[model samples]
Target: MAAPVPLHPARRAVGEALAPGELNLVGCSGGADSLALAAAASWHHRKESGPHAGTRVGAVVVDHHLHPRSVEISGQAVRQLKGLGLEPVRIVSADVDCDSRQGPEAAARTGRYAAFRKAMSELGAARVLTAHTKDDQAEQVLLGLARGSGTRSLAGIPAARGPYRRPLLELARADTEAICAHHGLTWWEDPANSDPRYLRSRLRTDVMPHLREHLSPTIADSLARTAAIAAEDAAYLESQAKEIFPTLLEDPDASGALRLQLKGLRAQPPAIRRRIVALAAVAAGAPAPSSERLQAVERLASGSRSRGPVQLEGELEVYRGARGTAEYGKLILIPPSSG
Candidate 1:
């Protein structure tokens, strides 16, 4: 067998995140990024000591079946994983629902995460690592900017979400490809990455190239830095909102909806105020509210007039009703009408 190429930086990140002997699962797509991650994880396992000694590394390739040869691609990934001596290799099929309002990419992403959660549970894995890199972060920032998204959207991809972690968020895509080449590993390139139909593909293959050539030489790195700063700001704001939430939310009604008292909420900064309203909506069983809906609820928090009651998607309604004071009423999340 050939020697596995070393990935010093990635190894360090994975090592710091997980204890020795713990199971580390990689979400591999046969692409260069994930393939390199798998190789790096294997090397990290080989060097483990203490309780982490003999750490088990595995790969879960989620097959969305959106293409004609997805299964073939998955099989090739399995072969490559086995060649790297990774155990517990599994391929999960995801049911992607495209009929909804969300874009195709989002639907697939949702399905893929569900599969990863299931894999974690069945494998008893302590962590799941993905291949999202700094380049992906730049693209995300661009999308968020184009859509006029808030700080949370501009924060781009997080390094860690629950049990899932992206250890390569600081690394570039070229680095992953180079790592694969150094290991003498072959990686499968997905056709979806190049298809112009997807906005992300256009951003990756064309828009970024144009910007790199004509715009600032370090545009990608700069955007990635923006994301890091935005992430920091978002974390602080979220912590503040959580602290203030208990005071703002009145007792739940018969319908289990939490009412937001304007007396305390109206004085907070807009960022924290919006987060409070959005969190209240989600807590009341509304799926994450859109930016427009969030703003609508925020206006209600201020006791705005002229505009009628705010009707959010999923039949969740938000309105201001007299509770404590006439001048400043409370904003409430009403459950979807059964009728």
Candidate 2:
């Protein structure tokens, strides 16, 4: 017997994630990946047992309003999802806001996820699924490599995060396209996909093809494998850091300043230690801290024992003040004043 089609695993993924008496949502973008996912999730929701026994399948189309064709694309997606028996279909616009320093892609992603989270809360959905195939994972790994980011960035898109899940992460993009073809389904190809102005678009159209043609036809698979390994390593290191993080924090000051012990931080492996500092930085409401900024934090921690307090960009300050026989002092993170 031949192997089952793309929807086979796709349905199984949805079943594992959902149970009876729950609502499952698919984030559709009128693209092949999401369209295939919606179809599979709808099928699974109609199943009798195993999982998704009494679940309802719904679709949420997020319109970033970035282009003139956004509304038309969203309408087409809604009609297709409705035809596939998706329920409670609706479209929402994302309010994309970002400073000049931020790129358009990053701003758009921020807006898109915000919209998804809002929809999830309002709809009371158990989980929101987006179709991110292996192609995306590979692209992410390459992008991370180009940026020289640490292992976490190279780890690629997670299968599940918060209330969002990517059920198609293990599948290839071709599988989704095939699934659409099999069902006689039509999908939208966003013009942005081929627009060289975007890094991702260029990577998808030019770099990846060149790499596959010249270096290896299996480049995507190789990169995806690299991401999987990186993710495993990152997950394990994160768990260790979580276990050790509490040991680094000292008692809060009268003004609610939180301190992380410099000695304890220095004792940890570089990976875990860096993660803890990054976590504290984020907790203090610092914007995405770059490697240089992170290194600055580390320098202050290990620098002159008699030096004055060093201030981080997030209003967090650290100084060499003794706390319980520890003269090197602790690194304290301060939040920006609410007022």
Candidate 3:
């Protein structure tokens, strides 16, 4: 048998992420990061003997149609993926809603992910690998901070969520660019990535560069490290909250309103207490409350001031049981139409 060929570090990383005999799709966008990922995935699947030996790799290109030449760019990516010997290369067009309340970037992302899901379902792929590099993780953390987000938000892009996997999270953007250059691949530069109208674009083009110059040359790495730590903490806290949550719940009333013993809730530390409140709200069919609203719920539970039912999204309400009643000293979450 011929000796196994050595692989590039990026290619090895991609190979390690794949399971043998699985059908995986690379989410390519003709950008340097995604092109490099596509190249690496192709290299991994071509290996005749290894952990990823029987892996079948394909590519999915989502055209958001935000730019005039979006279709042309997607065609280029498809040709490149085919050139790299990737089979089942698919191009999906995303219908981005400009009027979406989440803004253009998020709207486009929602549409893109929907397209990915459709392609995955049609191709019977096990997972879709994206090219969210370390730099992207750092930017996400900064964005979360700017929005005064909680630990979960600051946790940045997860390495894997559901059927989507990001194997390049540890690789720097520069490393992906180098890989593309080594493969003699020409990648597209998306203008929207640098447009000042977007907050992330401002951070990437201005804030990040300024921080790198004055704060630290490795600020991006530092931010990415913070995100990892935050992810760990968030996961641990959520697990603890889930464990303690069921014990605190009281049987639902005749109207299906949920209740929790205030004593059990107060016994928990603030972090765990707030999480339990959020969980209870969600269980009562309400959307997760904002930080300030969560704090308000806390006040309603333990505060001296008189405050009645706290209104939440999804037509749910939370309040402390009134004194002298069977429901006294309990937190009640009233679902819609339950009175």
Question: Which number leads on lDDT?
Answer: 3
**Candidate 1 segments exceeding 4 Å error:** 1-6, 46-51, 306-308, 322-328, 337-339
Best by TM-score: 1
> TM-score for every candidate vs. truth?
0.92, 0.91, 0.91
Q: Is candidate 1 or candidate 3 better by TM-score?
A: 1
Residue-wise C-alpha lDDT for candidate 1, range 84-114, written one tens digit per residue:
8888899998889988678899999999999
What is candidate 3's lDDT per residue for 1-339, written digit by digit as tens? 842322376787787677568889999999999999998898876567867768899999999988899889999999999998898899988888999998999999999999999999999999999999999999999999987868988999998899888988888888888778777888999998899999999999999999999999999999999999999999999999999999999888688799999998999998899999999989888888888788889889885466568888888888888889988988999998898
TM-score of 3: 0.91
Q: Give the runs in model 2 whose Cα sits over 4 Å from its true position.
A: 1-5, 98-100, 304-315, 318-327
Ten consecutive residues with minimal summed lDDT in candidate 3? 2-11
User: Model 2 compared with the native: what TM-score?
Assistant: 0.91
Residue-wise lDDT of candidate 2 within 1-339, one digit each (tens)?
A: 744567788778766665466777899899999999988887865556654567888989999998899999999999999988988888988888746357888898888888888888898887788899999999999999898889889999988887778878888889898888877789999898899999999999999999999999999999999999999999999889888887787766566666787778888878887888877767666765666666666776675554545566766665555547554466767655621
Candidate 3 local lDDT, residue 131? 94
